[model samples]
Target: MSGPAMFSRYEFMIAWRYLRARRSEGGVSVMTWISLIGIALGVMALIATLAVRAGFRAEFVDTVLGANAHSTVYMVPQRIENDLTDEVYVVAGRIQDYDGMAQKVADLPGVTRAAAVVRGQVMASAHDKSNVAEVYGIGKADLEAMPRIVDPATLRGDVAQFGPGIAIGAGIARELSVSVGDKIRLIAPEGARTAFGTTPRVNSYEIGFIFNSGRYDVDRTRIYMPLDEAQSYFNREGVADEIEVFVDDPEQVADWTLPLLRTVGEGAQVWTWRDASSSFLAALDMEDDVMFVILSVLVLIASMNITSGLVMLVKNKGRDIGILRTMGLTEGAVLRVFFLCGAFTGVLGTIIGVILGVMLALNVESIMAGLNALTDGGAWQPEVRGIYRLPAELRAWDIFRAVGLSLTLSFIVTIFPARRAARMNPVEALRYE
Candidate 1:
């Protein structure tokens, strides 16, 4: 005859009976409740933490790629040696045909758009307050094409009359105590170099638009001026300092470096967004991994409670186990019965924790808003965290990993107590009776 099947109905019945046993009768005790709650809490914490980490990383990368170029092509001075005199000289100080290069790069297969820009540092003053700003001279069309600047949520002013005025960041406007249609003076120190010395050129321009890119540094320190005006202020004239190139997929920008270098020709280098922000991204990734490992320890400790509960369960059920063993139940069957008890607790706890974690992650924005309101809007600091708000993204992989970790620890810790209960001799178990 075939032996009883593994984890059969009777085994489940026994496990369930044991789990529901009264505290005085060697049934499920306070330890069981504690273990269940601990696992649930540990799982919830892991999922929530991972979701927030993922969201933070995504938001940071989006802000960076949305507000700036995927790659930039700029001229770098090339060292050349004179053949006759053997004297070293520098050549190709600036892009000779930036517009042509931009047009050519824009035609490349993966490139979305290429715009030549003149960038410089200047002091902006209005209402007697002044701040240092990095100004980008770009065409109205190109400025509008930028994802972050054109976004309705962050844009505060109009870009229609861009050429007649300039677009300043919200932080800059606030610091200078100016607003749209107000005049802000831009002072360029290197304006008009002469025989005597360089003179600072101060010019007042109307603020046509304002944008908040959500990055504290960018919003506080960046300004956008019309290409022609920027060229004049920075003394670049017809040449551009760099050509900002946008692409369909920013992640693949490194793949296009060769093509961009070919298009821009010699003395020009391609600098990708990754090159500028790799360290920050790497740090975020490392932190995510470290946090997961650290939180897993909490889950392991919680699972240990299962061991304590199961060991007590085995001790309290010795008499019942003796009767069952004398009645022809196998040791393997007894082991499965107790194992199922612990496994059920882990599985149910994980399910509850997943539900709670997902709900928290989905509602994180609302919760942040509520907290900000209660705290008088002082809960978040964009300058310190780099983003104005907290973000939480629920990823399937993270959830699965948490579940696996919980279940694995639960199963491993259940083994020892299960084996002890299974190997007990019926004679010894009933000696007291």
Candidate 2:
């Protein structure tokens, strides 16, 4: 029976009997079911939490890219002149350069649009009302391409009128009590001086449109005007404060940014939206790492349960082990039998967990929709401090890592208990039984 011999009918019977008995009423205790449930719940929680975080990241990134370009090129100290034309026409020429550079940048791989932008802090006044806001000067065509300024359904007038018109945010519109066709006076920081010291040089313009992009910060503080009008009003010539570049592939921002910087040379600085919001990105990275460690502890706890269950199985089957050894089964064969049993538990648990995880991740949106309905849809309301809904992104890497760790932990858990079973003494066990 030792060499090239099939397993005896009795050996097969023994394995089958143990397997069937384990599956029956006496196989696992009440505690085992509790452990399995805990594992399932833990897996579900991790999947849901990660998905929501991922969703928020995706949404915010889109908002930022919509408002700002994928990358920005601006001068350090942001000078508007280069030793020319009373520093006035120099600024104007710089503003005009936006159109040319935008064309050039658009020709680069992945760049969709390039627009010159003039941004400045200005006081906007209408009648007896006044508010401080950031004025963004952009070409009418470019403004149409900008998401923050292109919500046609919410607009009071067309953005393409190309007159001395501006688009204000919905929040700004509310605060100023202003609407399309209303006139607002813009006063720049640099004002002309009269005999009575400094007189505020202001230009009145018609509000051509209003847009709301669901972002409170932008909607409350931003105003858009044509680039030429903005430069003239600001008394800047042949120069712009910054050049905003939109890309076809936002993921290629770093790639586009470096080359553009080389082209612009040391006169300018290149920045991505990621750089604009470093604090938030850092927080996201830290949150993701902390979640990974915490969820892994859950898997560890599950592995511990597997370890304990296998140990109990080993203890219960000691007499069987002894009998098999006395019946000419080698120590290696004895070890293999118990090892197979322990491995089976881990493999079975992992398979079940993976199937469950995939289902939950894939259907997370539908599940949230149902939950919202159950709560009378109140869950869709805005949150003062957090995103309203959860987002789950199931990357292949996450699945591979989870499965690999669970299986490895299960195998590790079984080793000590399986070894203990293999080293049982046949004589003592037979005498006791």
Candidate 3:
């Protein structure tokens, strides 16, 4: 027989004998039951941790991509005269031809879509209330190309209802105690003092709609207006702060961004959404690493239980080991038998834990709903935080990692006991009995 077939036969026979012996026992002992439970708990912890981490990361990516553009183009500080004119359109048209630039970025190998966005900081006031917020100006047609940050049905008024009006974030509107159709005054800084004193410009607008992006920064402090209207208000006739681009494959960001930067020339800077939120991403990575290390301690503790249980098994099967030795069984074969028994315990526990973890991940939303129902709707709802329920993302790698770790720990626990069983003498074991 081939090597694989021969090994398979040997493993099957040894595992069968080990399992048969376990079944004929006077039921399972308290210690064995304890070991089984320990393994089960350990496996469950690993599965739950992996699922939660994957889910949170996936949801965070979705939330960010929904609220912000995938990439950005901006002029370096003090480079271009902030004046907007027909020449501005000429430069924009030329830049669009560069590789990886323009609304056609989605046509690139991995890009999904691209858009141009202009943003500025301004103070908005309505009636007696005033607050500083970021004003985002966008082309009405291009806005449709990006992810919908706000649901039209959720708004008190329609975004497209007013021509020169603006949309306010839900949180900001609530804080200001203003609603749709309310008049809002906009104050923006324009022009630099050239031998003159402070230069300031102010404009006014009416609130058109209220939108919620599920992110506190965006929802609480962001406002959107028509591109042309914003330019007129800011005294920036034809110039925009930046052009935003969206991609289909976020993983290929670096590959696409570099070529686009080269195409845009030395005057323009290109940035990815990852660069925009680097600190947040770093924090999430650190949190996952810390959580895994902490949870692995549970698995280590379970492994200790396995070690103790195997030590007891060695004592109980002393005579059996001696009889097998007298019947010409090799010491290695004897060791394999006990190892199979311990491995079986780990495999069974891992399988059960995986099933339970997957079920929990799939029904997390329903589970949260049940909890809310039980609590009589007293739970805090955070529309600004993106998702309401815990997210669970299961990957094949997570399962492989869990099973591989458990089996290795099980084998390690069986080592000493298996060695002791192989070394037992038939004469001494029979004499003791």
Candidate 4:
């Protein structure tokens, strides 16, 4: 404290004293603590919101990818009669020798599984209920090839033999008021031609299993049956519509494009999960980014409070600033003291807020459940398996972005008030005293 080396140390001490002062002692005012609280609240809100966003993103990706393929290989569209069923023909763009193609593509590097599938639309009815259905023409082999379609634990009934039975989604079962072992009728537009006219065909299939993927859309509309049965029913036999491919890492689906294209050759076009649902995926990414921007605005607002609080503080400390200047304190040191006073609020708040936010985000599910229980509202426990709980993920980048932006804004806000403090007039300050 006696030497020139003590200049910065004295500045810190003076700042600390100002921060710890009571109202009568000309110390930190209530407004300073209020500003700190505001900054902390803003930071906590940002981190928790980002964690929720990340959690939802992961849940959606997992749920969707479970029921759908990572990528699909399709050949040019073609119209042909599956069999000698009727006068009219079925239009199907199916890959020629798809089994061989699927096998070849499966042999490619990074390819985990490939299955030839036939897809068609129909109206299914049972137990006085009807709904539009998407029939996936997949056999035991295809089911074995793609494990994401159904979990062994959730699946019910026998599917080993297939035996003209359908594996239906749980939502569809509920809608039709039917479960495993119930018979459902599928109505196809294609039928045998007669002297009167062409008639629609109706085929009956027994429900073998009910699968719940937690995806409402898929559960309510999609059904799986043997490929051969589907081709025969749709009057399009001997060819499959497309080959669905699965890989090791779905996040890297984009990276597998070139290798997949080269392996399958030019006759067919390949579509990745990203390509098939570009708008949906884009919407998720954009939503995350949009939320980040919005929350950053809140932090900026909180930083403004820091500027305002410090400005009020500087006005109250004018005599102190003048006295320090006359005691050999440099203007630069005076400037630094006020800057530290403001910056300290932001730094401390950010640190405390980070701890609180992480704890909140990680236990969001429990918090939601507790709130629900307290309110007698069971909204947290949804009936659907996939959407039952809140998901929270605290990513490093998200934390860094939020904390860094907050600190930067706080640092920027402190400059004007600090500069004003340094330029105070000792004579004018003392005359009032």
On lDDT, the candidate that comes out on top is 1
Preferred candidate (TM-score higher): 1 or 4: 1
lDDT for each residue of candidate 4 in 1-433, tens digit (9 for 90 to 100): 6546534787888888888857574435676777788889888999999998888778778876888889888876545654666555644466768789889888987888899888888889997789889999986877755444557876777666365578888878888888788899888776656798877889889998888775667878888988888888876678888989888898888887787788777766788888866887798799888988988888888888888878878888888888988988877888889998988988988887788789889998898888888977565544443454578989999899878988998889998899999998878877878
Model 2 lowest lDDT segment of ten: 87-96
lDDT of 2 by residue, 352-397 (tens): 7777877787787788789889999676643342333555677767
96-128, model 3: which lDDT tens digit per residue?
232234544445566665555567788877768
Q: In candidate 2, how many Å is residue 186 off?
A: 5.1
Tens digits of per-residue lDDT, candidate 1, 129-150, equal: 9999999999989998988877
What overall lDDT goes with each candidate model?
A: 0.89, 0.71, 0.70, 0.81
lDDT of 3 at 151: 62
Q: Which candidate is the best by TM-score?
A: 1
Write down the TM-score for model 1. Answer: 0.95
Residue 183 displacement in candidate 1 (angstroms)? 0.6
Question: What lDDT is reached at residue 125 by model 2?
Answer: 83
TM-score of 4: 0.86
Cα TM-score per model: 0.95, 0.77, 0.80, 0.86
The TM-score obtained by model 3 is 0.80
Global CA lDDT computed for model 4: 0.81
